[model samples]
Target: MKLHVCLSALLAVMASGQGVQAATPDAYRDLNHNGRRDVYEDAGQSIDARVDDLVRQMTLEEKVGAMMHGSLPAGDELGHGGAIYDLDQVGVMIGERHLNSFITRLVVAPRRLAEQNNEVQRLAEQTRLGIPVTISTDPRNHFQAVLGASTAGGGFSLWPETLGLAATGDADLVRRFGEVAHREYRAVGIQMALSPQADLASEPRWPRVTATFGSDPADVSRMVQAYVEGFQGGTDGVRPDGVATVVKHWVGYGAEPEGFDGHNIYGRVARLDNASFAEHVAAFDGAFAAGVAGVMPTYPILEGVSLDGAPLEPVAAGFNRQLLTDLLRDQKGFKGLVLSDWAITNNCDAACRAPTADHPQTAKDIGMPWGVEGLTQPERFAKGVTAGIDQFGGVNDGAMLLQAVRDGQVPAARLDEAVRRIMTLKFQLGLFDNPYVDPDVAERVVGDPQSRAQADLAQRRAQVVLEDGGRPLTAEGVKTVWLYNVDPEEARRRGWAVASDPAQADLALVRVNAPFERLHPHHFFGARQNEGRLDFRDGDADYEAVKQARAARRSVVAVNLDRPAILTNIRDKTDVLIATFGASDAAVLDVATGQARGEGRLPFELPSSMAAVEAQDPARPDDSAAPLYPRGYGRGAPRN
Candidate 1:
């Protein structure tokens, strides 16, 4: 036994002499339980000094983890976020994975979300680094029909969706909406809004138009700037009361064929063949001008596209140095960190080419190497980092990143640079100074009564009258009716009679969605695929019902245009036709009852037919000739 022990000691010493290094304690010290009074810990140091000190003290694993903003385990909670989650998983993500941030998905109770966030921050604080975990959320303040925002009216202010906001053409109101959303976000311990989707809504059939400002680049730019101003509270940096806006998809996302989303390769592949690149850049320019902190790079899984001469061959802005490092960071003069869209680097599997496949064929949470389907998972990470991106979304593993560094694919200095940017935001946000939130405060501020009233007013203001031939929907005539989109309770509360049967009413009212191919929710979100074209066709159940109702009685119809639906068949069927981007059921009813007049105008063209849709180029903003409803089409105050 003595001989064996000596041999083991000698081997270890030999290994050390061969340059094998053991894990050493980082530069942090805990003398007097106050931690080392390093420059990074000092509140009075320059931002550069603080970032440098923090980078030097972090272990490679910690530095890698700092670059990940993974998804929160929202499965066990209330909403459709993560597939599964519990306290143990949270522990692994923060303590073991060393993650310091998570994207908030799906909706839980307001207080419940706050409590969970508090618990998460507590766990993060207990880690060796004690970095507070930042929480981010997609847009949630609006009542968008599709899976745009995760939550709807979940104990927060409810406003019109972005389309509705655009229809209003009120930049000031958009900014105000931003302010409200930011306050509520902060109240719930959410520090980031992965929104103000600066992508132009030129693709009429695009599924995500519900979340856009509009198709007009100039107009969209103005709103984008306003949104940032509101969310960031006009501060060039993060503030305790402010929220950071991650202007998304970088650029050129809305140009997808028939308006498919970029959650996968096909949707992301359909780019503008000859569209105005300047217009696309204009949107990001607006956001950057507002001093936004970060940009979520666009998914570029295309056949052929070049930026400044470099190709998008590996497929993704996350891996394209020309687009991320050169164009955005160098030429465009953007100085913010670039974050990859969720799982953009995931390795493709059985459903690699069929992202919309059902059941087992659906894509998994494994790496989705869309453009660079040829690269391994570790190589994908290294590629993204080399492209000048600072972080990966929804990626929890830091081991792969460490491996990449060891392999010399990503230099330690490059890793440090990424870590520095991330740490700068955290410190600037004062998360290190104070990460805890008062649930009581969240309750008081979030969904406050005053905020609700503003939301109501905004909702009322955003309804657009597409066709008002005979003033058929005036308040007097809407008293007794069959209502579809309008909330029955709200209509009744307003002294309007609500009829259960369509035939029992004097007038028939219907609410229909912008059309698209229906796929399982799991396929659309969990796998991030299955969204398809936007042309509304004849003979669908809802369309038939609306047609039969119009034949039966004087009818009023409101089509909540999530996208510019193919309106050839339904446009001429109703006596009064209205197009609302997204409003409350009550807000719709308010317009129908003439309690509040819709001041909104159509933000994009409503195509006459699918042929028109197919005939036009995805790059052209408004080339739908003889549109059923042209851009900026709306009737105001009954043409009086």
Candidate 2:
């Protein structure tokens, strides 16, 4: 794996001579235009030597371009509640930015995604150095069914969300999912996965619980190790067959101040004291053990937090050298890419707000350079670099990077260090040899039938039943079922009779989501996805809907707990109570009818009431209010 280039290839590259020789009309000779074969172009050298050679050859502009990773011109995909939407902002990030990496979204067709990625690679190849672009993406194959957060499988095999995966509690199954995700991603030219968040879900009211593994340190730790192992094929470094992982929020983000989200300024720190830090860092410790390829810092303030007596200024992790360099790299011995969360280096003035028209509660538009608000953009970049961050997400500009170097604010050696890490990934992924993807292979592999079936099995394993209510859930005599929010056609497909009206059915199957009361509930209306929070205010529409359905007939209520929710409003209003972390309708139906029994357990506790949630210590883990259902409480059986 260490060897890359051959002597014959080097001779072929070197024979072109100086001044860029021309060959074969359309094909230009000396693709790198260096006239002589550079050490970087030779795959026969060690990775460190190759990185050093590439760094030496790069000018300031090229080096800056290598550091930036910008947004791609999003193509047609299910945007904002299944609508035909794309990132319509017209910018020259590609032609002008010249960044070697891109953060992309899923396209409606897998082939089109691969084709567009190939086109981006072509764009990058046109540069002087000809570095192949590495496409990075958020989690796209999960079944969370959100708009801004995730896509609708988009023809890729859909597996349970991370919460669902944790629910299953099967480390091997998680590893298998990593294998599937890597295969599908590579087929479409996606080399990086900005996911597998190692953060805990200790705070029940946290909004991003849909993305976290679980609350318990032990359970989350197992999943984190297995997931990285699966994606990296148990290798300590990046591989051609592997899709490198970016384990996120580096420190725990579950215990947000007052249970609010950290993407915005109001809730910036994981308020927990230094004593409770171990549980927060538990899964990350496991990620370190699993040898993850990259780490993403959270957008939260850690004013009073520190490791090994190192003094940390009250600021976001991205700008803290003590936290990043002293703690993560030196103390913990992490050898991976350190990436900042999106829009962190920019300023967050009043006018510089995040996008809130769609997913209101989680929008983060303004810059979040918490402790270094006094510094200029170039100064901020210099600080992050000095803090041990390898790359800056959300923006792909090198003006600040170049200026930092010119001002003597950042050393050239630091730039080389960052570029070396970046170059290693590009070389290790085998992007230097062949970067373009074949659309045909993408079409077949993105959702291979075998992978899809395995995903379905994982889905089945993740469904959890809390209370059966002394009722035989899947009685043979129960034929007609009324569905509220549950798809009628899907129920009929599952061999059950579907009735539109509750009064006209044998049993009413009401599928309602967990209650969420956002802090600001305005400017969010039509064509938008649901927001996250645990408060179910009295007379809420969703709660009222379930109550009405239950009154109409003897109903079975299943709550989709994207995050740990407060179910006091509708807990006693139904016959059977089921908690689904993130599973398919078919999986839910199978579990309901006893066709497939759930083997999963609750990963977090459901709060008894909003009052209980509000009274708990926001600075501590597993210190929530009285629980309606505690963690690891799956009654009767744990069957797949």
lDDT tens per residue, model 1, 1-640: 1112232233212211011122122322121134345676555677788778777778888889989888776663222554334668778988888898788774666667667777787677577656778788888887753343345656789888888888888889988888888877877678888887888777776667778887888888888888998898784645545788899877677777766666644455756542365677776777878898889887755434566665555466778787788888898887766888877767656554444435433424334466777777788889999988899987877777778888899987788878888888877665654555656667777778888998898888888887776654566644577876556776678776877777777777788877666453433343333245555557676787677677435777788777787667776887777787767777777776677888888888887877778888676677777788787777862342
lDDT of 2 by residue, 75-133 (tens): 32211322222323312454455578777764567777777666676665566677778
lDDT of 1: 0.71
How much lDDT does each candidate structure score?
A: 0.71, 0.71
What clash pairs does model 1 have?
206-259, 315-371, 346-367, 346-368, 346-369, 347-367, 347-368
On a 0 to 1 TM-score scale, where does candidate 2 land against the true structure? 0.88
- Residue 147 lDDT in candidate 2: 42
Each candidate: how many clashes?
Answer: 7, 6
Off by over 4 Å in 2: 1-31, 34-36, 75-96, 145-149, 352-365, 521-538, 551-554, 636-640
**Structural similarity to truth (TM-score) of each candidate:** 0.89, 0.88
Error of 2 at 450 (Å): 1.1
